[model samples]
Target chain A: MRIFTAVVAIAAGILILGGYFFPAFEGMQALLLNWAVILAGAAALVGIFNLVSVHTDKIRRQEKGSVYSALLLISLVATFLFAMILRPNHATMKIVLSGIIIPVEASLMGLLTISLLYAAVRLLRRRADLTSIIFLVTAALLILGSATLPFGNMPVLGTFVGPWITQVLALGGARGILIGVALGTLTTGLRVLFGADRPYGGN
Target chain B: MIELTIILVSAALLFGITLWKRKSPANLREIPALTRLHRTLGLSIEDGTRLHISLGTGSLLDARGGSALAGLAMLRHIAERTSVSDKPSVASAGDPTLGLLTQDTLQAGYQAAGVEELYVPTSGRVTGLSPFGYAAGAMNISQNENVSANIIIGHFGPEAALLTEASDRDNVTMIGASDELSGQSVLFASTQDSLIGEELFATGAYLGAGASHVASLTVQDILRWLVILALLGGAAVKLVGMI
Candidate 1:
């Protein structure tokens, strides 16, 4: 069964990749991609069911935070029913997305910024290497340079150092990381294609 | 056409080297995060606390799939090691498809270790579909489940900081990695020992997935040098043109 699954996966991958290189198989590629998306959707439905079942079981067992589990189930069921009845694009959906989801996510982003700042301060405490010192100094400079002054913006510091730090140093580091990620992605894909690594649960 | 050729040639080189070097030992550089993973797992088992592995919000069909798959490979290794313990390592993913894959990896690991009865469906779960939702769910688990160690490697955004913070609050040993650059920055600040850039992909190799994974890492190193050389060559050409 694992071999069969691997074979199917390889065929699908090849077909999709071939379609990109060969125009003749474009339709077939689209069909296969659609099939994959559908399969994913089905898997997501199963996941939803599993989530509900797990929470239900937790509540049944009277586990810690069972009230939270009950609340989660109720919220999920309510949202599902609303979506089914009122349609997803209704005003209620917009309100939920804009008012509830956006605010919650925004608050989380704020928390992340604070967490990052706190971590920056503790970086030296954790590992006081030269690299850590450099990281801390760079972070401090960027923060100080970017901060608003009482009189006016510190153009020399903010305009110069901020852009240099963010545009040059940060961008360079990010690009290097991105290049590494791309190389890793290619190797991983090739590994799967050549049957070197089977992530689909095969031996 | 050039891109395709380069990919094909690189893959061929990788396969060739893998076959040729299969029997030879791989002398890989020391990765502290990976090295500490074994000890962390042992501590988790000894402490009778769960080891949490989070494969972040990455889908199987998207670009993030590679990282998700890599995380699954790591999951297999951790699961096998923890299969004998009363509480095996638990896995969570933001994507349901990846979640299912995580479960399969767990089951496969247990089966391979001849401890099929230790496999539990609830051990691998899809925490949430959205990034923040997933982070929240995973954070709750890390805090409440008495997690001794939290290994997070996959695609994540800034929301990952929340999980890191939660784990930190609980005094859990956190090792993190992410394919996204922004996520990497967050992880760098937050994790105790974080895998940077392509290091996440090396987890399988470092964890003894197989010789193929080791060979793949070697191939990556070779390709990286090639890229560096190409960049230098391009810069030199521009310089010559200016002269």
Candidate 2:
């Protein structure tokens, strides 16, 4: 099994790299990549089946915390059916996505505010470190600078100072995050390409 | 043909270097947590510390393939270890696709271990469509289930803190790794072992569950070196131009 997997992986990588370097073989390579993507898409059904089967059993057994399972199943099945059967146009789909799914997702995201605040408070309880101090201080300033309103009515210190502090940290933090993300992506991509990491099938 | 030849040549060169290596260190397989994953799982089975795995809400496509792959690798490792030990494990997934892959991995691992009946779909539960709901559901499992060790890996967002907080509160020995820094920060604050960036990519290899993941790490290191050189060279050129 291991040998077979290794052989297939080597072949696939060769094909993929071949497609990248050889413009003449682009069509075949592109087709292979497309198939790889399509295969992944097909594999998604495995996930859907797992979701349905698990939730259905929970609903049947009426287990503890099964209500959430039920809700998840209903939402999933409803969305799938709505999309498949209704055949909603792009505009309508957008409305459903934005109005229902987005709001729920966003509100859930908003719930993170409480979690982050809680996490922040927990950090404050810990032994002081430079990283923690920096994190806490930046978080506090960011929160205060943004939430504190009526800057125009306040003194120059309130208006200019708050905005400047927030903007500088926000921009720098954003850049750092971008760099970290890019490096992470590059590393992950290389891993996949080199057959260093195979998540598809297990040992 | 040319590209394939180049790749083969480079791989051969690397293979030769590894074979003919001047001794840098005695140990090549010296990752602490990754080594611990297999060891801990085997030990926990006898001790009865149920494995808790949470796959975050970000879909494979949402987090761009890598997160999904990482999550799957983790699933395979836990599944195999637990199956071998005849221990129970819970896999709670935020995304539907992840839930499915995890389920399959669990079942297959059990089957491989010749305990196919123990492989339950409920083991890989799809908790919620949204983040909070998923977090809440996953936390409920950690609280209610006999889970001894909590392992959270994937594309967790803000709700990651909530889940980690609950895991910490439960006094569960946890290993949390995420591609997102915010999630990583939250996990690092709360959990014992938290992998950041490319380290997350090494989880599979380190666990000895996925050789490809190890190979991937090697490739990642090479890419990093290339990127560093490119950046340094570009900066040097720019400096020269300014001069």
For each candidate, what is the lDDT?
0.86, 0.67
Candidate 2 lDDT, tens digit per residue, A1-203?
A: 75577568767766766777778768877887788667656655665676678667767988777887777778777777887876767576678888987787687677667766676777746435677778677666655655646643345444665677657865666555545555455445445555554444544
Score candidate 2 by lDDT.
0.67
Candidate 1 accuracy as lDDT:
0.86
What is the per-residue lDDT of model 1 for residues B1-243, given as tens digits with 9 covering 90 to 100? 877887888889888888877889888899999999868888887877889999999998888898988888889888888888866788998998998888888898898889998788888888889999899888877876767889999999888889988888888899999999888878887776888999999998888888888988999999999999988999999989963
Q: For candidate 2, what is the DockQ-based docking class? A: acceptable
| Model 1 per-residue lDDT tens digits across residues A19-92 | 87889989999999899899999999988987887788789999777799899999899889999999999999
DockQ of each: 0.73, 0.33
The CAPRI quality class of candidate 1 comes to medium
Task: Pick the DockQ winner.
Answer: 1
True contacts kept of each: 0.71, 0.36
Model 2: residues with Cα > 4 Å off, grouped in runs:
A1-10, A36-41, A71-100, A126-128, A145-147, A152-197, B1-43, B57-63, B85-87, B92-100, B111-117, B125-137, B168-171, B188-193, B208-230
- For lDDT, the strongest prediction is 1
